[model samples]
Target: MNILAIDTANNFLSLALHKDQSTHIICEDIGNKQSEFILPKINQLLTENDTKLQDLTSISYNAGPGGFTGLRIGLSVAMSLAYSLKIPLYPVNMFAMYHNALNTETNSIIALDAKLGQIYLAGFDNNGDYLIEPQLINPEQLSSVLSKHNLINDDDTIITGNGWTAYTEIFNQDISSQNIQYIESNYPSAATMINLVLSGKSQPCAAHEAELLYLRNKVALNLEEQKQSKQ
Candidate 1:
């Protein structure tokens, strides 16, 4: 099966083509100008691979809990591609993509800077199974939320994503555990997107069902709701 994967849900704009048992990620571009270059980059990838849009068996993308505009752009592209090509679209989370990016298993948390001093967060066990449902929360509330839900692990916890860079001090102070491993190099990639495309894990959905996975219903309203819920 041939699958095309995309991830523009963050600063990174990447595209991958998965064929045979090996993954061929033609390009993984990182920049702030996703809106300007995403489709052109995709076209370049297909042209380089000597493939056509209709040749893909599936389309996979990072559906987000990240940037509002980036998420909308990526999901729109994925849905449009799937609709035009008559292929299934899998809206995988950036955390799931991060999980598959891992070369080895370990208790890990994936966070994406959700702006306004909060992040989109999720966890995975050593087996890469989801330990906590994905949500948007502030760095100040992260530790307490984990404790309230009994999701804290004494084992070394690996943390990755743009959030780590943005809220380093807050996370460090809140986590408290001495065994935290922070990875600063990697970002979500179309290569990780291919993991789902190749696994055949996504179900075909109607065009209407294909939508952005905004962890928070209304990004602008979340801060008010969080404050009200706390009060």
Candidate 2:
């Protein structure tokens, strides 16, 4: 199956085409400009791989717990394409993609910067099951959120996401220095979304039936708010 995957859930635009048992990817940072670059980038990836939109059997996209505008742009594009193509649209979240990229072989807790003094946290099992569905928590409550959700029941759990970088002191209080594992958040892959779809880690639906996954109530970011999620 020729599958298309898109991830504009952050400052980056990542698109991948899974075809012929091979994967082709294009990822770049075009901060706050996803709407401007995503279509062309999708075309670029498909063109480079000798493929077309109609050739895709299904589409997968980063359905959020991420940047507000980015999620909307990604969903709008994926929805439009999938609707027009009459193909299935698979819904995957940024946390799942982030955890899957690591291939850590252990359950992982993902804590992304949610701005407004809150962290967007979620956890996934080794098999890509959600131990903690994405939620917003104050930085001070990071430890409690984990405990309350039974998220990090063991010390070996892999902790990821940009929240670790943004709120070091807060995370250090929860995840000890010795237990700290830094898996850079920039490594998110649209290819992983394709793999998740093919593996049935997420289900597919009609484009019209799909919706954006927004953990935070608001999406638009001011310059200072944007600074809150650096890296």
Candidate 3:
């Protein structure tokens, strides 16, 4: 099966083409310009590989809890292509993409910086099975949450993601005694995204159903408050 996988949920913009069990990827840490570069890169990849959008069996993307703008661009492209080509669109979780890149078989916690002094977090076991549902958490609450799951006492636990890089001091202070190892890379891989779909880890949805995996609901001010603020 020929599959096109995209990952623009973070600072990295990655696109992969899977053909006959081999994968080709265009990955770069080009922050915030994914909206500008993604489609051109996709066209370049297909043209260079002698493939066309119509040849794609499926379209997969990093459905996110990462940067809101990046996620929107990725979903927009994926859904548009899938709908036009009449192919299924697959939504892969951003955290699971991170977990798939880990070299360790131990318990893994994937985190992404959620800003507002919080982090997006999820846990997976050695087999890549989710242990905790993804959530946004304040750094100050790190200790209690891990302890609640007994992860605080588990030395085999490893934390990996950009979340750690952005809030190192807070994580170090809170979980240093736990002896959890940290890996430096946080960017999700389009190659891994393809591997995930090939292994049946991702599910395909209708193009209209393709949406960002935001863990939180939309926040809005009340009508009276909006009027007061405007005044």
Candidate 4:
């Protein structure tokens, strides 16, 4: 399988090219400049590998619960490239990738700092399937939601993604578990996205139908709009 993947959901901006069973990455750029840097990196990778756009069997991208600007950049490039290349665009959930990266004996909770004291969170079972729809909530609400979803008392649980950094203390004190592993090296990356894409498990999205999964719409709204909607 030949695959190309891009991720700009967090501080890490990455691109990966996979041919056969080997992977080549073109990264080390700042995440904030993804829009400006991604295309050049893509061209560079293709050139280095002696490949072309039409050579890609599939293209995948991180569909966010991430930086507003970075998400737009990553998605726009992905949708445009997929459309132009006449290939499918796969939207890989950040949480799913996080779960797949873990070696957990049970469910894995993927969380990202949603800012404003809230987190964008999702849950995945041992087999890397969605256990709950993604949502925006604080630590208490997240715990409550997990309980409501019947995910409590997970004896062998592992929590990952950027959310761990924000809610580690709360999770350590509150969530009951015999084993909890927080792996920092498993940060979100396009390379991980490509792994799922090649495995044929990523959700296929069309150019027009593709949408960024911002957990809270209000965060994207202006202050006046937010106040008006509240009223």
Candidate 5:
């Protein structure tokens, strides 16, 4: 099976082409230039791998809880390609991808810095089951959330993601005595996303039904309203 996976949910733009049992990936920290770089990179990957879009069995993408513009660009392109090719589109959560990549044996918190001093948070057990649904949360509130779940003092608990890199001091100070480990992975793996689909963890949907998982919907709506007011 041939599968294509895309992840433009953060500063990194990741693309992967899985053909047979082999995978080819292109990952770059391109900041805000995903709109300009993603398609060309995709084309380059396909061409280099001697595969075409029509040859793909399905397309998968990181469906949000990251940067707004990046997620939109990724989903629009994925949906359009799936619609045009008449192939299934699989939506994978960015946090799930992070969890899978970490391949950890302890309870984990997958977070992404959502800007405005907020973090996109999701928790999973040592066995990779959801401990908490994904949410946009302030740094100050994270301690309480962990305490609520009795995860605060668990030495086996670890925090992983770009969120830690962005707000290191805040987390260090807030949860200083917890003895939790932090891994500084800034972006999820595209290869991991493809593997999730192959393992049946990701279910495919119609192209038109594909959508980004923007956890901060209310904040997004408010920003839109503010923009309209200025206009």
Candidate 6:
């Protein structure tokens, strides 16, 4: 079955198409420009691969804990495409995609930028079970938060996500894991969703049933809060 996947939960727009048992992936570091590039990139991906939009049997998207506007754009695009194409829709979690992509043996933590001096994090055990659900926390409070969850207290715990990528200096100073590791793969890709699809981990549903997975209620901050957050 041919499938198309989209991930615009962050600045980068990542698209993947699977056909003829081959997977094609495209990732563009277009910050805050997903709306402009998503459709064109999808077209380019399909055209370059000799595939048609109607040929896709299913579509998947990263239903975030990410950028508010990015999630809206990606979700709307995915749902519209799925609805029009009459194909099933798969709503994949951004963090779970990274977890699946890394396949790390030790406990792992996914921390993605939430802006306003906050981050979205999810903790998983070595067996891929959730130790902590996705939630927002300040980077400086990571130690306390992890300690409260008792999720990644071990010596070899792995933490990988764009949160670290975006604030490497902060994490290196605030987080004191001797071997704290952040993977080179900090961004999400539709290819990761394809991996989940192949493993039957990311389930599919009708377009009407697809929904965004938000971790918090505060989407935007007041001007004063924004100014303070930078401090």
lDDT top scorer: 5
Q: Whose lDDT is higher: candidate 1's or candidate 5's?
A: 5
143-217 per-residue lDDT for model 4 (tens digits): 677778776766555567767688778766766362445657457556778777766668787777788776777
Cα RMSD of all models vs. native, in order, equals 3.4, 4.3, 3.4, 3.2, 3.3, 2.9
- Predicted candidate 5 versus true structure: per-residue lDDT over 1-231, tens digit per residue: 799999998789999999979999999999899999999999999999999888998999989777788899999999999999999999999888988888889999987888767898999997778897898888888888889888888888998888777788888888977877887664557999988898888899999999888677687676777789889
lDDT of 4 at 110: 79
Q: Which stretches of candidate 1 lie over 4 Å from their true place?
A: 26-32, 149-153, 200-204, 222-231
TM-score of each: 0.84, 0.87, 0.90, 0.86, 0.89, 0.84
Enumerate clash totals for all models, in the order shown: 0, 0, 0, 0, 0, 0
Worst 10 contiguous positions by lDDT, candidate 1:
198-207
- Clashing residue pairs, backbone N/CA/C < 3 A, model 6: none
Winner by TM-score: 3
For 30-121, candidate 3 gives per-residue lDDT tens digits of 88899999999999999988998889999999888877889999999999999999999888998888888885789988878876557889
Judge candidate 1 at residue 99 and give its lDDT: 71
> Candidate 1: lDDT over CA atoms?
0.75
Q: List, residue by residue over 97-184, the lDDT tens digit for candidate 2.
A: 8887888788788888887777888888888888887888888887776677664447557787888889988777775644535566
**Model 5, poorest ten-residue lDDT window?**
180-189
Q: Compared to the true structure, candidate 2 yields what TM-score?
A: 0.87
